[model samples]
Target: MSRPRPGAGAALLFDMDGLLLDTERPVFEVFVEEARALGLEDAESFGLSMVGLSSSICQRLLRDYLPAEIGLERFRERWDAGVRARLAGGIPLKPGVAEVLERLTGAGWSMVVVTSTRTVTARSHLGEAGLLDHFLDVVGGDAVPANKPDPAPYLIGAERAGAHSRDCLAFEDSDAGVASALAAGCEVHQIPDIRPPDRPVPQRGQAVHRTLTDAVAAAGLLV
Candidate 1:
């Protein structure tokens, strides 16, 4: 692997959905739209709750959204369409994404993406945002057996970047992502998109940010 850019020490592993693109809202929107067919509102709320898990795991966890008489495959079909439309409209990077990434890239930070999202979906978001070139390597959900909260993704990301797990910085927007990176022994920062219902303080040990730019700025990724 190529050397990471200056100042950041080694690698920076970025989450694909909420980190690279504003996918959380739109993803839940798709869920809500699909749930509407089954007479469920607030799909976005319930959907967002499953943000960091693998899609299949999330689907299983949310199976109750579908009527027993109806197969989950149908719900998936509808949800897929909704998501495609949202992505087609484009999902912009969170505030400061460009500034932080540009600064880091210029400074020679080796960067890659490790996401619990399918490559097809990942490509749609990052490609549309015109940020695909920024990643030196990508590990999509479909490419891995274990997902976020498992540590496998982060470990693979660090390995691919040719960096020590502890030497890498991971940017995440979900609890699962934070846990995964932490389990792999990487330093983590969280760009909180939404507060949980039970945890008033959100999760701990994470450098919380209102946006990716803020987190990066705090980490001095701009250097």
Candidate 2:
């Protein structure tokens, strides 16, 4: 596909959720509600940990919390409901998303969204944010075998975006998302949202920024 003359960036990639929109707050709020309903708020978030992890993995990670009285089936139902509620409420795009996306796309940066949520939900946020058309393709959370920290999502997204991994830039938040992008050979820019650093994320090879605009600027998406 013919694209504009890429100014400074070769290609621009982004992760959904915390990277694209302020999704975690609503998600966590729903989780809290579910936990309150199930009486496992603290334990559930501990298991549901990061944004880019698969629900299956998340469910298994919290298996320890499943009492013999509370089976996995019920846990799954309630958790899915909570997630559905969060999605139903919709989410907001992070500040500077539209400016940076427009800037990068105009500069011929072939941008794609590689996310860990289902395509429907990913599309919802992008559409809601008016950023859906910015991406050439989207790799959803359910599209890959393993989610972030595994490299599949990023690799697949790179392939779909017609970008070589080495020639692409990944914008992400969360440790898992950073690791996945780095592992896929993209230079990663990590914007950690409001997540406090309790443990080191994969920042050794990453450009760390506080916001999408800063990361996009640092990645050469803006002049």
Per-prediction TM-score: 0.88, 0.84
**Which regions of candidate 1 fall more than 4 Å away from where they truly are?**
1-9, 41-45, 196-201
Name model 2 segments beyond 4 Å from true.
1-9, 44-48, 71-73, 76-89, 197-202
The per-residue C-alpha lDDT of model 2 at residue 173 equals 83
Q: Whole-model lDDT, candidate 2?
A: 0.75
- The TM-score of predicted model 2 comes to 0.84
- lDDT of model 2 at residue 165? 77
Q: Which candidate is the best by lDDT?
A: 1
The true-versus-predicted C-alpha distance at residue 177 of model 2, in Å, is: 0.9
Instruction: Return the clash pairs for model 2, or none.
Output: 116-141
- Candidate 1 structure quality by residue, lDDT tens digits, 181-214: 9999988998866555666545657778788777
